[model samples]
Target: MNSSRRLVVAVAMSAAFALCLPFTANAGHDDNGTDPDNRSQAVKGFNLTANGTKAMNHGKSQLERSVITTSWGGGDIEVYDKDYGDNGWHGYADCTDWNALWTSCDIIRVRFNQYSYKTSSQWKSLGCHEFGHTADLGHRARSNDTDNNSCMREEIWPLYYDQHDLNAIKAGT
Candidate 1:
């Protein structure tokens, strides 16, 4: 091809490549950031029901296996199972305290609603969802997930993080 043709082809290929690249922006809400120290998070449970305990354990395990580092001890993140009847929420996560720079969360709180009447698998899904939030992840819609397979969805489904979630976490923390 002529030099002019080659240049045009190269520019087109670069644009296409850039368009195909996955979104690398952090998926989590900007209000909370990863743990300030070493980007590792420590999770603990409090006054949890039997189901709640199981859920919390599942969440911790999943987080540990993901790109976001997590441990079973320490109180960097606190999980609680409560009976919030018909409040229209299965679970939620919040940053109770912020680091000195206000960029990361010093303490995060995760809560599960027992009134949701979820099955064991559903509880596990909830665990994964809430834990994602504590990691600064926002809710993902089913339409947004190409495979429709992510616990980060607003509803309780899937038991683990998807590649998109991992990529977002990696980019964020």
Candidate 2:
């Protein structure tokens, strides 16, 4: 059983790797067209290229474990880096305005900003955090009495989320 599971994981990983191909040269950006930082509504889908693809490949298992492949409107999130030619985990995720990538692919890539301020520790958790978003898991509560520190928002410093955020992710907010 363990062997079969490993085989399955390996195959899945391979397929995921295959998917990463054919998009590195052209995976685009808004190019200062519109800043997603202003939108509260779910951002659209896009592609993850080269290093972004590699980062997702590195963390794809975690994302798959968190239900990365689901038929929902959660949207696509392209993972990427400013310098795909370089070798490093940019450590970020963002959704571009990509509705044509795929209808179900609302959040296409789980991006990584190569020059981000995030460290390894933060990137590790960021991968999970974006996975949560892909799974429709938003931030969780950060109070003293809830399931704190186990989710994206809680993990974010400066207390990005409160009880409502927790309730949202848990309750699909």
Best-performing candidate as measured by TM-score: 1
Ten-residue stretch with the least lDDT total in model 1: 29-38
Using Cα atoms with residue i matched to residue i, what is each candidate's TM-score against the true structure?
0.77, 0.39
> Which tens-of-lDDT digit does each residue in 79-140 have in candidate 2?
44454434554344434453563322234356566565655455555555554555444344
How far off is residue 40 in model 2, in Å?
A: 25
Q: In order, what lDDT does every prediction score?
A: 0.78, 0.43
lDDT of 2: 0.43
lDDT tens digits, residue span 1-173, model 1: 99999999999999999999865455544224443333688888988999999889888887776676887786688888888888889997887888787656788888999986789998998898888777667778667786878888776479998877776666666
**Candidate 1 RMSD to the real structure:** 7.3
Q: Provide the global lDDT of candidate 1 against the true structure.
A: 0.78
After TM-score superposition, the amount by which residue 28's alpha carbon in candidate 2 deviates from its true location, in angstroms, is 32
Candidate 1 contains a number of clashing pairs equal to: 0
